[model samples]
Target chain A: MFYREAGQFKSTYQTDQAIFPIVQDRWFMALVFIVAFVVIPLVADEYWHQAIIIPFLILALAAIGLNILTGYAGLVSLGTGAFMAVGAYSTYKMSTAFPDLNIIIIFLLSGVFAAMVGMVFGAPSLRIKGFYLAVATLAAQFFILWVFNKVEWFFNYSPSGTITAPPRELFGVLVTGPEASPVARYYVCLVFLVVFAFAAKNMARGRLGRSWMAIRDMDIAAEIIGIRPLQTKLSAFGISSFYCGVAGALYIFCWLGSAETEAFDILNVSFPVLFMVIIGGLGSVLGAILGAAFITLMPIFLTNAPPMIGIHLAADLQKHIEEIILGLMIITFLIVEPAGFNRLWQIAKEKIRKWPFPY
Target chain B: MSAEPTVGRKIGDVILDVANVSLSFGGVRALNGVSFDVNEGEVRAIIGPNGAGKSSMLNCINGFYKPTEGMITFKGESHHQMETYESASQGIARTFQNIALFKGMTTLDNIMTGRNLQMKKNFLWQALYFGPALKEELENREVVEKVIDFLEIESIRKTVVGRLPYGLQKRVELARALAAEPDMLLLDEPMAGMNHEEKEDMCRYILDVNDEFGTTIVLIEHDMSVVMDISDRVVVLDYGEKIADGTPDEVRANQRVVDAYLGVQHD
Candidate 1:
């Protein structure tokens, strides 16, 4: 009665390797794209675009970046914020220096710059593992943000030490800076999100993805079996950082319009993205999106609950409640399902396949 | 016993020459002046008592542990030093005494990973695995599936290796190493911890691999009967030094081999 692949036959490797292997899955994805592009853009209010949809897409991309490193490669990294800082700053420099290049081009170039930085920080992973690697990446998170804060040239020598993404256009419509409409910015984020998300999915399913998984399962066995640890680990960092870098650029240009170093703070960016990967499911693209949605939506419920119940708490107290609630929710979710929502999703699918029958 | 003799070059002159290879860890010496050579297509066995450095010698050949002294020449090319990945690329493959399969991955993925050295899709093509990359992937998958069938593990092909029983995991590990289609296969106690039935099955597979594929094999085994029945040549080690080297029957009669390996108390 539910989803089934009984009659589906794979005639070629390409067909077998399709991202949406099932007909139902293909339909589901088409529906999602239609809702995101056609329906939401036309129907959603500015609050929905600015406060929910735009931030959701940007964070989902970031979460995917972290998921690639920790979830797929089995290398726990805390340098996500640092890599994002690299991207945002790189974009700032590229846009200001050229003043004529397209915003999309600048976003991509910034990712390359961040990927290089990610590789440098990822070098220590060859010798150290697990918690030690996490500490090393945490060091990168702090160090890069520190550099961004201190370097005057990065902010164009502005007194405020904040970089405002200058006005940029796409096909004669301003899509960046404060002048861009919420719809225009959302479209920009949407297009890049689709491209990067598709690229990440394909990359994770192929040889390079297998290489990362091999390294994740057992480093020594991977080495003995001919997988180069140096290359595999570095490639994971590069691609992951590339995604984070682009998202950072998008966050500054398409969402925030202007950002300070604190916007890339470790507490704000690194831990949140890590949580998104954990709650969503590591090593899963769908989980990354699901996780971003969960993290973004939960705060609304947490903060508004007290108000609805006729308790007006101070802003700081409200923030504490959100933190406590998030912490508890994460802990509970992990204890219940260490593999996270992806595993839950899988279990649900299996259940539906055997509906009205004993599992 | 059912194994047909190897189809290709049955056996040829020495293919690998290990000369005076000695290994040490900190103050302790694992091997001292160990020397041996295996001819092509021969099932060469290295038998030893515990701590006799049988595993260490295999490690040295695969370049996992650098010899503190001595040399190893494979296919007549002397190796000064080499990395583990380089040794694999050179067609020297091995299974661990302790199973080293990728536990989180499926039997299929684990076997597919064996084709890593052979698959030539670049990162960009692999990132878009729809054109040439897909073709290459399917071709290699077909080869790996054949190995899976030969090992009689088709039923467990999709199972994650971590959940499998020990004997099955060992077989899967061997299948993975074989999927590489290497010239030489090194096995560290391939039959260790197996019951008699499993041992017999593994022994048959090894013989068939050597026979049908003409692959040069050097294996470390503790089971005396298993070693004597299969190996064309036997090299006995005692405390990291070669004590006897000959045909299995000759080594069985040697006083030194019996004293060191068999541990017979002489009057």
Candidate 2:
């Protein structure tokens, strides 16, 4: 009864075609926003903000980027880490070049820089696809990492070769660098995630998103029907990279405050982000965030919970066990539900709607 | 073809002209020296058996396949090659024989994609999905809705097309092509996997599209019965060459056409 639509009526096309059309869904979204914007910030401790929440938010943004490409546009990319590195480097360079500008603006511009690089790398995608394209992007991953490693200018030729984000002030309060509070960094990540996530969702529902999906569905048919495969695909890469870039910037500036180039090592960052997209559900924004939570929290749970249960083990051994579980979970999730967590969410909603009877 | 005034217009209304066009993939020649002109407001059917270059000819016309040698002129313009989207924007739209609906997209979204060239919201507006982008989207949604209604697919408008029955999926493909408001419609095989009732439905819709909008239709169909009933003119290909070009009946009567279809007697 709680989930039923009952007598709700929509009087306009805009209202009828809303993102959250159901009244209950709208209320639920409103409640979520209230909790996110107000309640959690007031009550949550530093540990939650630093260890779990901040990473989740950053990874969720990256996963959404990958989802736009692989999920909506059917362009598999392993260059996510590369694109993110561009963002991080861009943020580093931009902030250093112009310290007077707001860090948020720098973050956005960093994504644009990453987007340009992403589109350049995405050119080959027009000619090659599937595993071949993935291999091509894998090259981007390695080459970008190499460039960052070899080119000392990217890290500002620091002795340690680690780029440090200096503390930046917003409204007379610090928001980045070592001096900034975890809560401040959390707020920044949260805000960017919310804004960018909604922007991505908006795109997925519109003409642009439709073009991406069109190219994904059938390239030959898409070509005949007049959707330019190259343009559609490149735009997907551009936009997806833009989001990843911002996430990358946030990852370094807000969460790490100081990051070695190795922090963005492809295996650790790109693979995990991609796994989130797969487990979260391809093409669903909510799935990205949910997947981020699952990935971010699971390791902590795995490592700590085992010890709590008197199954104490070395940290190295625990990490191997964690990897095995995570890998198995991914395989099981893919085999059982390719639609991922989004499909599960839909199924639950459907069950609630059809309660009391096995339809 | 003899007395169809709605099609055939006058002599100067040639919308698409293919002169000495040939296409090949490495050692295999798909189309060899095929020449044809599609006039304004006509159902120009290109029918042939499998591997007879029917699909290849359509691909060449729509800019998917570059002719190994020859010229293709469309609407008085002659370009050696144009991008597929460029051809589409120049008012060419097509459906696939294999039914190429965006599987992840809803029927509405799939149809809206057909109108991609027409919807011109810029990146900034599209990202926000507000102001001009939203306006353009809602405007296009109306067009897609009309297409959905025309194809009698309103029930599945919100449904993802991959889950649809094969017949309905084919209809959705056609609807998507029509949503482009194309001047020339290239249908690879509109009625390939349909039952009698579904084929009849598709036939009526195709006829209605040609009649109502004066859309120049180029279809590839194996069904001789449907071809005879619908096409104002038919171009028949066999073994990478145009064996016959005339009215459906004339092509049906041509010796080369009969030989291509039934094969030469070897006794």
The model with the greatest DockQ is 2
lDDT of 2 by residue, B1-267 (tens): 223545524323899999999898999999899999999888889988789999888888888888889999989899777777678888988888887778888888888888888888777898887888888888888888888888899899889888999999999888988999998999988899788888888888988888788888999998778888888899999889998899877887788877778354321
True contacts kept of 1: 0.62
Residue lDDT tens for model 1, B140-185: 9889878998999999987889999999999999998999898899
Badly placed stretches (over 4 Å) of model 2 are: A307-316, B1-12, B262-267
Residue ranges of candidate 1 with Cα displaced over 4 Å: A305-316, B2-9, B264-267
**lDDT per residue as tens, model 2, A19-105:** 888988989999999998898889989888888888999999999999999988989999999899999999999999899998888
Give fnat for candidate 2.
0.86
Q: Provide per-model DockQ scores.
A: 0.64, 0.71
Pick by lDDT: which candidate is best?
1
Q: What are the chain A TM-scores for all the models, listed individually?
A: 0.96, 0.97
- For each candidate, what TM-score against the reference? 0.95, 0.94
Which CAPRI level is candidate 1? medium
- Candidate 2 chain A has its poorest 10 consecutive residues by lDDT at A10-19
What TM-score did chain B of candidate 2 earn?
A: 0.93
Clashing pairs in 1: B6-B211
